[model samples]
Target: MDEGAIEIRQLRFGWKPGECLLSIEAFTVGRGERVFLHGPSGSGKSSLLGLVGGVLLPQAGEVRVLGQAWGELPASRRDRFRGDHIGFLFQQFNLLPYLGLLDNVLLPVRYSRLRRQRCEEAPAIEAKRLLAALGLEGEALLSRPVAELSVGQQQRVAAARALLGRPELVVADEPTSALDEEAREAFLSLLMQRCRDSGAALLFVSHDRRLAEGFDREVALSALTAAPGGVQS
Candidate 1:
């Protein structure tokens, strides 16, 4: 197997003292692999993602992304590392309401000089390519405020943003929950194709098993947690 895109060893985390939300002896996702992380409603799925993304530190053990331990980095460095190496798609499609869609998609490049350097074309050109791939076209649509787009359109914009500059790892948290069945499948197809094209490992967390069929592997977040009572903090 190739080097791990993400690796966790004896990981443990909790929001409050004496309350363990997640415990995982070992978890790994290999380079270019797509893994469906099965996380039901009350599972510590979100917490796991936060740890992997370096938004939350483990109480014990380690999280390594692309072979570097996140805990070793200072907070500012960790944030820059995350911007350069990871792309995130949240369930809520967190777009700046006032920004134009293209500008929103170009945000990562602004923050990470490494990501900007990785772009094959100018940032504007690349943004357009990604948005077009996700089925948003025309200068008019690109120029419109994100607030005016429908939920599905906004979701596509979010996907495009996550995919910009081809970060090494793409982490998505229940990104398809708001879409209808057909829309969900279509979105997944596009997202997966883009990840593969960019050689990015995908860690997609969702409760929907049907979406797990074509993934390289399936992981149950429930099984990873040793804490009792499905404690999610």
Candidate 2:
């Protein structure tokens, strides 16, 4: 069986003509491994995640998830595949304002039929379990609007939401920016534990080098810049 790893062969992307934003000659992320990617601002970290999550198409070569080429799939199929295979956590808590915390966490199910079917329990139950695991278990808070929660609580809620469907790949972009040292460590521990439990490969991107120490491996995009605006298959 093919392993659930992200494999890239000569992947390149550019929004504007003649100026490439990202180009990876070759890169692979193994299952159940935590990888920290450190980049300064405008290093194309977000773009790399966007490619892996199937949000942006590669200009050349291929991006494969679990051995299936992302570019080969149709746009609709690609979206579904991304939803089922990759979980994205952005710095800004993108939770819906009107939806309650639990409801916000269940957003993936609304777009992903596969996740909805494979969910072990009803989504509400699953959300509660995830919430508890992330250390937020007050019954009164479950139904509360996200605006009522502190930034740290919102971060944990986002973590729970990202990990809810048990995606093979979890892409987190500077998620701990708002956290203090103690809170950051606690959050990292829970997220790493959950990723291990789910057997997901965490490709966490951060601008801070301190966070890289906790991960199993680290890779910098500067090394993979062999091709200026090209990708080789």
Top-TM-score candidate index: 1
Task: Give model 1's TM-score versus the native structure.
Answer: 0.97
RMSD of 1: 1.3
- What TM-score against the true fold does each predicted structure earn? 0.97, 0.93
Model 2 stretches with alpha carbons more than 4 Å out: 227-233
> How many clashes would you count in candidate 1?
0
Please list the C-alpha lDDT of all candidates, in the order they appear: 0.90, 0.82
TM-score of structure candidate 2: 0.93
Which digits, one per residue and each the tens of the lDDT, describe model 2 over residues 1-233? Answer: 46557889887788776656777888888887898887776677767877888888888878888888888899999988988878888887667888889888898888887777767899778878888999999889887889999888888899888887778888899889888899888988899988898888999888888888779998887777654533221
| Residue 107 accuracy (lDDT) in model 2 | 88
Q: Distance from true position, residue 56, model 2, in Å?
A: 0.8
Summed over model 2, clashes come to 0
lDDT of 1 by residue, 98-144 (tens): 78888889999989999899889998999899889889999888778
For residue 194, model 2's alpha carbon misses the true position, in angstroms, by 0.5
